[model samples]
Target: MTDQSAAPDATPRPLDHLAAMGAPDALALVDRAGALSFTGLDRAVGALARALDGRGLAKGARVASWLAKTRLASLLPLACARAELVHVPINPLLKRGQVAHILQDSGASLLIAGAGRSGTLEAGDRPADCALLIEDEAGAASLAAQDGLPASAADPDALAAILYTSGSTGRPKGVMLSHANLWLGAVSVAHYLRLTADDRTLAVLPFSFDYGQNQLLSSWAAGACVYPLDYLTARDVIRAVDKHEITTLAGVPPLWVQLAEADWPEATAGRLRRITNSGGRLPVPLVHRLRQLFPAADLYSMYGLTEAFRSTYLDPALIDTHPDSIGGAIPFAEVMLVRPDGGLAATGEPGELVHAGPLVAQGYWQDAERTALRFRPAPVFSKYGGMAVWSGDTAVMDADGLLRFVGRDDEMIKTSGNRVSPTEVEEAAVATGAAAEAVAIGVPDDRLGEAILLVVRGDPAGEGALRDGLKRDLPNFMQPREIRWRADLPRNANGKVDRAGLKAELTS
Candidate 1:
């Protein structure tokens, strides 16, 4: 792995990642509107930045987008950075309530959505001060545009984006990211992955995800092309790879499984130079199958959290000998395993994973209590000392200093590449009056890393209503795989429902 070292005095903003890129006429982005060259990409970002600044919002205003993966949607991150605004991209799969919480929590001054999406918001869902614009009507049209702003530079540490992620409990919290964090992250990944201008990355993941956002950022940093696709099925992704001659692909374990199940032309599969997995572990058997299918492609197994952006990625060469290991720290990150008392863990001993470095996020937005809990002072042994993300995940470092994930210490359920909050799901169910008492737990599944199994003490006759309500209110990933009703739920000594007891019983 390349050791990342960024000098103290010089730091770049997010937009600087794309500045001075090679070959202005080379392809940079491809979407429904058609392909955009490096020149076109710069013009698009400049035009969008101009339009956003003309809205009369303050320089540090929060701008959110809830549109699907379109040309404009794909370019908003860069545009927002150029305008000195914090961009918040919401997952299109999120329901109206989820979108509302993000806007209100981030205090977004403007939101851009499609015309049909505006009516989806119910009363009180939108903040009073927030302005809405139909993206199609906003019309980012121009081939010759330049940044008219003065040569004044932006602060690298200024907040650039607020990415909302479902915590272990309560509502989803926003993770604050600075310009340097993003620019360095892009540099780190692009350097390690050896991306080049000839590579074409097929961006299939949602922009809200940190890993997904990098698909655009890293490619731009390497002066490569990114083809964003909003695929409805696994077949759509397979066809796109052949059609676009995609060379780089990133996915979670669940998505990798879905793509594996679909039939692929050998020639098309060979076109992929590298594929990556994060969010969840890939079973050893599946890893073998992927290697067999894509003989020419390298497979990267990674582990990350939103607070730190990324932690470790196992090199492709180690997949056969150490398929279970999460490898060592990525560039610009310091990964350490700490004991219960905050001391360093001995080799082969399990401890909490702590990440410290420039890649670490600023913290939770406007919520100091939660931020203080997760983002604490770095371990005494850390080389990059400051604030570090104390990830509540248990892991062990091998003698070679490689980390192998043991288990999660938190109760968050990871399903289909999405982190789900158990409490949030239960609260929504109770609000629908489907249950008086509820306990949400994650059950082991073959496909999804963890499938939600909701147990409630309510009328069995309300099953139909509960299902319908959840379908309407929750995202597809957050929906429970099965609903079971009981007369009583076990309680711990504190008098709260025992989610641990339910998970143990169900999984056993």
Candidate 2:
């Protein structure tokens, strides 16, 4: 295993670093609609931050966003960081109920949403005390015409954002990240990825996700352009890459599968210099296919969590021989394998993957019980006494220090790059009143990599109604792709649903 050490002088915030680059005229963000230069982006963010401050929301108060990957969403975090308010980005695909839970849980005072998405917030039944700000209006000249408010002085250790992770309970837990945590994560990723001023990145994932948000931070920190696209087809990605001459593209395994299947022009493929995979591991066949398609790009296979932002990444050079390995720790962080007995595991031994160092988040917001369970004291031989994220993911480190993912220690299902809780789906299914008992399992899917499969013991007559009920209760990604009628779900000796056995039934 690699020796654990600290990085020297990791002090610069992402926005401050970018502002100091002195390339204000360079492209910063682009979409199918248009582009924003660095100068334009800075002015817009400044105006929005000032506007948010003028609303009298206290510093460190959570400002939630329910929007797509628009320029406003791209710039919200930076503005929040400057104003010393925590930005809570709600996934645009999330249902109103889920959005309401996040808003209430975070106690967000100001909510910024798109003009069309206002109905979602209204339907969520949030408290009347919360103020609503439209993204379109905030970006317009009228809001900018108001007086500029001074930026709030914030400590680096203060909370910046609360990202909710899918949990076994019906409710999601917020992963608390500080300014220093996010800033260092951006620096580490940018340094290891070799992002540069001339590079342009394509962003397909939502900013609500940790890995997805880093695409904006790291690229901008390097003074590079980030093109955010909401793609509907593989052809859309190809067109975006060619149209923008994108040098970097980050995606999950499902996206890689689609891209590998879609025919790409030789000229378009040659322009992409880096391809990053996270959210889930890419199969060997898909990895080889991607290598063949983008011969000029370096492929990086990464593994991480919302709590730590990132853990390990397999180097592009090792793809040929160790395609499945989730390599060693990136710069500014330390990853360790802790055995069940609460001791360090030897090489080749399976254990819980432990992440320690600067990138570690503050903990779960307002959920002390869960936070205390996951975030604990660092094991012996650590320089700092801060909390280390005990990722409930089984892994093993090779003698050469490369980490390989085994499986989840918890019963969480990662489908379509979103971490979903089977219990959450089952609860929603049972709540529909059609199912006497329900079990949700992730079955392998060609398009999503993993799709939710619901096994229900219910009236066959109500199956259609139950499906419709789930649609209203869950996000598009959380909804089951298929529903199977069963007399009863398989159970273990403890009487709980045997998710593994259920998954096997579908796959076998």
Q: List the residue pairs that clash in candidate 1.
A: none
The local lDDT score (0 to 100) that residue 283 gets in candidate 2 is: 83
Which candidate has the highest lDDT of all? 1
How accurate locally, in lDDT, is each candidate?
0.86, 0.82
What TM-score would every model get versus the actual structure? 0.96, 0.93
lDDT of 1 by residue, 1-508 (tens): 1222442222456554463364788899988889889887777777777777878889989999997888878888888888899999998888998899998999999988887777799988889999988766434433113553321266889888999999998999999999988888887788777788899999999998999999998888888899999988999999999999999999998898898888999999999999999999998888988999898998998999989987899989999888888998887889999999889999999999999999999999999999999999999899999999999999998888888999999999988889999998998898888888888898878789889999999999999989888888998998999999999999999988888877888899
**What is the lDDT, from 0 to 100, of the residue 444 in candidate 1?**
79
Against the true structure, candidate 2 has what lDDT? 0.82
